[model samples]
Target chain A: MAPIKNGRHLFNEVPVGYPVPGKTTVYDESETIDLETVPLNGGILIKALSFSIDPYMRGKMRAPTKKSYSPPYAIGEPLNNHAVGLVLRSENPSFKAGDHVWAFLPFQEYVVQTNVAHVKLLENKENIPWSNYVGAAGMPGQTAYLGWKIFSKAKKGETVFVTTGAGPVGSIVAQLAKLGGLKVIASAGSDEKVEFMKKIGVDVAFNYKTTDTVKVLEEHGPIDIYWDNVGGATLEAALDAANPYARFIECGMISQYNQTSPYGVKNLMNIVGKRLSINGFIVSDHMTPENAKDFYDTIPAMIAKGELVFLEDKKYGLDKVGEAILDVQSGKNHGKSVIVVAEE
Target chain B: MAPIKNGRHLFNEVPVGYPVPGKTTVYDESETIDLETVPLNGGILIKALSFSIDPYMRGKMRAPTKKSYSPPYAIGEPLNNHAVGLVLRSENPSFKAGDHVWAFLPFQEYVVQTNVAHVKLLENKENIPWSNYVGAAGMPGQTAYLGWKIFSKAKKGETVFVTTGAGPVGSIVAQLAKLGGLKVIASAGSDEKVEFMKKIGVDVAFNYKTTDTVKVLEEHGPIDIYWDNVGGATLEAALDAANPYARFIECGMISQYNQTSPYGVKNLMNIVGKRLSINGFIVSDHMTPENAKDFYDTIPAMIAKGELVFLEDKKYGLDKVGEAILDVQSGKNHGKSVIVVAEE
Candidate 1:
């Protein structure tokens, strides 16, 4: 073990409505950390390679609260998310040095993971890039798969409407729905993102910023299912467009995530007449053995066969993390936003 | 059969926000009609004894649109609902004169039913009143039974929150939940209604007008299940008060039915973190033979044992129908609002 210079950003204070520019800060050289400690029993010491920046992180940035699904980042501590890394040292018998692992870790150059369950060695059998573990084919892809498979129960010949269709989870959901013989309608913030959704074989793609969701649905509904990633107005539109016995899968409310006062969903009365079912879920709850097996077996095959496509908006270094988060929060990214912490 | 003077009320026009005084009009010197005229071979001529005035009629009063669950009342046609009657004449082999039957008919003194399926012979076991068919022991009772049996799946020792607790459907839902060994919390519009809910074995009851729903929930929350008969603010509070994996049975949105613009539920983001499932259904969709059998076999037994109680606010004649509707809409009725169109 030896002292190593570790540069990292830490969460300073809770944001009011949106993250302030100084909410996250990269330390000066004088504050560099020493990575001299050995990993605890069943633990691995790793160098961070890449990190995911998602809309859900905005909820965590609020003053630490128990109401959030995941634990909030402690003030003055580095924020954490799904990350891909290279193992520099291992105190666990199951893993060794040079192992490429995936774990829930912070945005730091190096770290010691004491929980073995949170860490997994990456298997690159098809020569897939390591960063894919943090984007599609990883947490996001599995999430899309499980939500579609379990919640939506999308059937062949059925029509589906997906909001935030260009984001990591929504994009995967659209592709999976298309592959399942469903007619897919997708909505995104920007025209570029809308084009990307159409490129991925969505039956209909619209820029929600320019197009009225209810108007689009008036022509195309009554939709059989609505895969909701962005709630609020989009959800109200979906509620209006839904057919009898329609299923609404609530995955994320990115539309309301940063608002000081979240939008109230009107037209919920339609639920009764339409016999609608709105179910909300977190990805971690659906990571069963069967779902994991299906995710690992089916998704990569779809990718290799060109039947599925995923986009990654990657920034060059850890210093760009805060800006990357801002880009995601503002819906500037066309796909999964990731920060490349170090070169492989 | 001879011509008889028949007095009835007809739907004149759709209401803008709430029904105006003349939204429905009673006939001045009603037309006399011959009962001999039969539209179809299988027909039963009946005298309407009693009719139900329910909240769902508000939707029917909207500008006749195909979007609503039930068909709108034709501008000049008599409004229809569940009514008990005496069969005056019959050409159908399934019925005979002097038989008491229930059917979806109008508020007139008499009518002809060509469809046998829409009418059922009433069973008077344990000397249950015939009008009870339109109240606690009939459609509303069956609805409460099925919603709880299918949606809530409430376990003993769990807690349930019911909105509109003094209404026919809401009252039954609270009692059923209590009988199933769950602590029941109910909300109503008036102090008298709150007292009624408490008398019906509700563990906690509140007047929603004076007490803030969210504040009440903040004290007694993390509720297990919310049986929503009144949506809007109460639904928002339920969303906030929901514990992990809470189920919300969407029965009715009485508060929003008449509004030109419905209330927007604000705390929907909590659905994702809490993993809540909000489901809606029309009772007709769930009236299986098994459910009907259970309702007939169990509910009457509970009533006989004094384990269940139901109230009916019965107006004397069809002339009182409009006032009864307004009472139900304004949350003034202490129980199920019904019109005794003819004396027993």
Candidate 2:
């Protein structure tokens, strides 16, 4: 086959606040790759299927000097995250042509995957949407599942408050808490997202933009658990409404990700008086083989049975990757933001 | 028996900042108690021995409308705290005359104790100082023990950073961490207190007043556990120095106790990236019969055997109660601040 155009989003500059679509990340289509003759070197060649754009990626677009759980995106390098791709050519036995695979893929249409260690073979036995693997059956889903399972310790009739309720992780956590016989109070930025929260059977859903977070919590909670996705003001409100021995699952803090000066949380003294347990975790740390197996064995089947539902904000093509990430960061994207590079 | 003057510290006013020694709390010796005729009502007549003046009491000096783990001190009432007393007479079968008893006692020279449920008989088998019962072997000791035991999850070779390292709770926690084979980094406000930390075998002791907290922690930490006694800025420094999955035992926040505006902790975002577990607790909550048994059985013996050591800042007489509490609130007290009303 002849050389083909390969479009990608490259880290152009370090962002001070919200990453600019063109400046922080530039869409470069000047690259070309020969599909049939590109050297695999005992590796697998993959055609990018879809990309999972998450709020955590915002933390990665920083100066390399700054340390975080995730590595910083180097200037002039392809910005990467959890992405699903179709294996087109295989020089390794583990991955064959036509097999779908998932890994931390760079934002590009075609890639030569030399490191197959972290790359996982996707088993879509339930035939869920290929993009769904990057959302509900993927990192965000496992995060919600393991975090809730391991940390929630939810008892019957207890209340849980989940922030960013319409997002993938928050939505799943809210649903799980509800299934575990909890009263779910959730918040979203927009009215539409709030409606989505209600549709998903959240007991109390509110638009944080218009409503006072503390008042809502005071009315609906003395929450037993807090699934904190957006930290800052929401976390303060959670602390105010927290019942004694409240468990706080600090999954993400999207609200502070882009701020030059992070929000100063004033009421953490409540953490002592209320005996609140605040646990911050990255899902990657808990992605043991046993946990991943359990997640895959249980979650995919639930999604297929329509018991666990997830919403996706689908953005077509690799060119839209920058916009998708920005949408996720700014809470413009209503659901799990996905960049579709090619049709399955 | 003849009538005796009962000097006490009464809550005269609710304070906004630091409680005024005479205004917020007034020294009252106006009431004379007839020791023989005063009705105990089928309870015990006790002579107050010593009072524990701790930072948590500052929180209780707030307006009654505010809620907390410990109830607020009502105006025109005697300010109470963990105290040791000698029972002069007893009608209850559980206690006898001349027995040393410990309970939450008012800062008075004499008292008629009717409620004996919460009161405990102090068995000073090792012949330890009676004031030590209200300091190390009392609530602060149990707090240090339980908070460290239940929350720390510390492993050998791990590092623990303790603030207020010379206080009753911090001192015990520091010693416990050291005994558990963890590297202990402790901070105190004064040079003398830092010297005490060094005496108690803290691996790295620093005067937070003279040396920078962040600088010291950076030099010796990446701490696995933080026994947080003084919250505010020190808590921020601990967060910065935290290793992944750091355990924060939020025992107290003396730094923010008297502040009109609580410190706005800016780097709580590090909580998520570092996968920190911050747990706040009141020692009373964990003082289950079983836990209390374990604590009394283990800790008192440790202190007696010289495996654990504690220091006390003894202020003589009921008139000094207000000053003692002031010393505690201001970090002026070198050790556990105790007001000695009478000798054992």
TM-score of chain A considered alone, across all candidate predictions: 0.95, 0.98
Query: Comparing chain B with the reference, what is the TM-score for each candidate?
Result: 0.95, 0.98
Task: Return the clash pairs for model 1, or none.
Answer: none
Assess candidate 1 and give its lDDT.
0.83
Candidate 1 chain B lDDT trough over 10 residues, lowest sum: B20-29
- Candidate 1 lDDT, tens digit per residue, A4-121? 5676767777776667555554432334444556435667788899999888888887665555778887888787899999987788888888889888888788887888786877
Which stretches of model 1 miss by more than 4 angstroms? A24-42, B27-29, B34-40
Q: Write the per-residue lDDT of candidate 2 for residues A1-344, one digit (tens) a residue.
A: 88999998899998889988888899998999999999999999999999999888888888899898888999998999999999999999999999999899888999999889999998989998889999999999999999999999999999999999999999999899888899999999999998889988999999999999999998888899999998988888898999989999998888888888888888889999999898998898999999999999999999999988879999998778788888999999978999998887
Model 2 DockQ (Cα-based): 0.87
What does candidate 1's lDDT look like per residue over B1-344, in tens digits? 77778778777777776666555544333667787674536788898998988888988876665568888887887878898899988989889988999788976888877888978887667667778888887778878888998999799999899998888898889988887899888899999999999899999899989998888888877799999888888888888788889999998888897777778887888878888998998998987888877778887667667777889899887767778888888887878888897876
Error of 1 at A39 (Å): 5.0
For model 2, how big is the iRMS in angstroms?
A: 0.8
lDDT (CA) per prediction: 0.83, 0.90
The alpha-carbon deviation from the true structure for residue B312 of candidate 2, after best TM-score superposition, in angstroms, is 1.5
